[model samples]
Target: MDQTTSWGILAALAALIGGFLWEGGHWEGLIEKTALLIVFGGTFAAVAVSYPASRLRQIPESLKTVFRPAAPDVPARIDELVELATIARREGVLALENKIADHPDAFIRNGLQIVVDGTDPELSRQILEFEIDAVEQRMENQSKIFESAGGYAPTMGIIGTVMGLIHVLSNLADPGSLGPAIAVAFTATLYGVASANILYLPVASKIRIRAADSVQFMEMMLEGILAIQAGENPALVRKKLTAFMHTEEMSFARKKEESEDGTETEQTQTKRA
Candidate 1:
């Protein structure tokens, strides 16, 4: 599970709720079933109408992606690619064929298959690049689904508020109910804005980030495959792929270095003692 995404959502809700309570607002004021039904139900209906049935079918998977993002292990992939490059350099490109079955990622496997088949390098790169583009486009479309929901949610909330007002206006003879009715009407607006910012828009942004990371990882693999097919040295292959490591991976590398340094220092002191 993506703890950052999960904790971020919880923190946002806690801040909002805590601030409201601090301001002497009652929790009951935020609980309007009619407003919730209108904003959420209407937002869903709008999103369903906006996207195709096939796209709609992916909502569950999309939601899961936002909550449980699959981050690629960049260092591990680099090591694997360097190993493959070494194997190809020593034993020939055909050696990769045996390793392809053991590979987990289809992208890496396909790239290796092309190399093992003696496909022209330029054509292989084009095919792999095209696949990467298609995957990116598909992920972009999926993110847009949530983006569309974010766009529509606030408008739906306004519509719900308007509808509530109309009902309140129609029953204006009950002066005692005016305050509560107005509060209920405004709850729809709160729901719409909060859900859009907290859920839909954030999910879209997370998906986009994941898509970019995935593309970078695939590109690194493609580069490794091409390098191996061209018989690049394993050290050079490792050098090229390390460029794909993001800041987080760099930080991890730094921490690992520090740990090793500490271990070496402790061993030296122990030897002296």
Candidate 2:
């Protein structure tokens, strides 16, 4: 589970509800079944009309990705790839075959299998790169679905609000109910705006981020595998793959080195003293 996404959603809901209560608004005033049905149902229908049946089926999985994002250990991946390169350099490329089954990532495993099988370097790179592009396209499609829903949600809410206003206007004979009716009519607008900004749009953004991360990781793996196939030095492979690490990862490495240097200096001073 992604704690940031989970906590962020919780924090947003808490702020919205807490602010509403602080403003002396009753929670019951926000509960309008007709408004909800109109906004949510209409939004879904609009999205359905916009996308194909096959793409619609991916909504569940895409939503799951929003809450439970993939957290790839990039540094660890680079380290593992370097180790694999070392093994391949020490033993022949065929030696990697024994470790292929033990490799956890299917992408890496497939690449290694291709290398072990003595596939043409150009062909292997082409195949892996194609797979990478395909995966990225699929993820982009899924994210776009949510993005389309977000775009539709606000308009659906407006439609619901208009419907409610029509009913309210028709019943304007009772002046006493006008205030409550107007309030109820606007609830659809609130639902639409809130759901779009807080849920749909954010989920689409998260999916995009996840997709980018995935593509970066795969690209790194492709480079590593290709390097191994080319019989590059393990140290050189490590240097090249390290470039894929995020800035934060690089910062952490720098901090770790500084701490180690300080520790060594302190030890030397104490011994000299």
Candidate 3:
């Protein structure tokens, strides 16, 4: 999976155990199942109660956000479209039919297919923009779900803590049981704080970043499609699309140039991240 996520979690757990060992010189099953059940179960139940079924179902994707790679750069994408445009100009848009299957980036492929099918430029732009908006909206919803869950987690933790305290107070006559009961009571709060900070919030941030990157990619494709429709020169279109590439994307182009002695610089890879 994602090494960052894996390593961060492993390191956190190792540090936690190491701290405990350093303090007490031994390890015990310090975690309490009942506390976890109350905190985690209650927080999840709260999310289910708060969000719609469709939104709740999208939570898994937010978790996957941690491991998912970022979207490919827009400049690199422009390069690919330039190649396709060159081919279409020399031959015809119909030649793209076979190339569509070989192409990467579903958005570009779909737009190319539309042009090849002779859709009017205005209608094609409208449809592509609509699809982009839909995808962006879905991603935003997923991010908001985690944000909402993060908002709810600490409250659930407090609830769990209070519930534990209630148990501890109930057993006031039994001094021998007070220590473990108090520790268990506070454990729920730890779960809530930890889950929200390390899990939900970070995932939501990643989703937002990915959504923005994807939007940029879509914007580039829109420009490429419109230029293609107007029968602009491929070199000109490449120049225009270059404006959309992030700084990091341009670095990939530099490496691509070095790999093939700049001759194959025109034939950039069509793959999208």
Better of 1 and 2 by TM-score: 1
Candidate 1: segments with Cα more than 4 A from true spot: 251-273
Between prediction 2 and prediction 3, the one with superior TM-score is: 2
Residues forming the 10-long window of minimal summed lDDT in candidate 3? 264-273
Candidate 2 TM-score, true structure as reference: 0.89
Clashing residue pairs in candidate 1, if any? none
Q: What overall lDDT, based on C-alpha atoms, would model 1 receive against the true structure?
A: 0.90
Measured by TM-score, how close is model 3 to the native structure?
Answer: 0.82
Each model's TM-score?
A: 0.90, 0.89, 0.82
Best by TM-score: 1
RMSD of each: 5.0, 4.8, 5.9
Instruction: Write one digit per residue (lDDT tens) for candidate 1, span 82-157.
Output: 8899999999998888999988899998999999999999999999999999989888999999999999999989
Error of 2 at 80 (Å): 1.6
Q: Which stretches of candidate 3 lie over 4 Å from their true place?
A: 15-17, 25-29, 70-79, 101-104, 254-273
In candidate 2, stretches whose alpha carbon ends up further than 4 angstroms from where it belongs are 251-273
What is residue 188's positional error in candidate 2, in angstroms? 0.6
Which tens-of-lDDT digit does each residue in 1-273 have in candidate 2? 988887988899989989999999998988999988988999899999999999999988887877876678877787788888998999989999998998889999999999999999999999999999999999999999989989988998898889889999999789999999989999999999999988889989999998998999899999999999999988688778877878988676456446756998999999999
lDDT of each: 0.90, 0.89, 0.79
In TM-score terms, candidate 1 sits at 0.90
Error of 3 at 192 (Å): 1.0
The best-first sequence of candidates by TM-score reads: 1, 2, 3
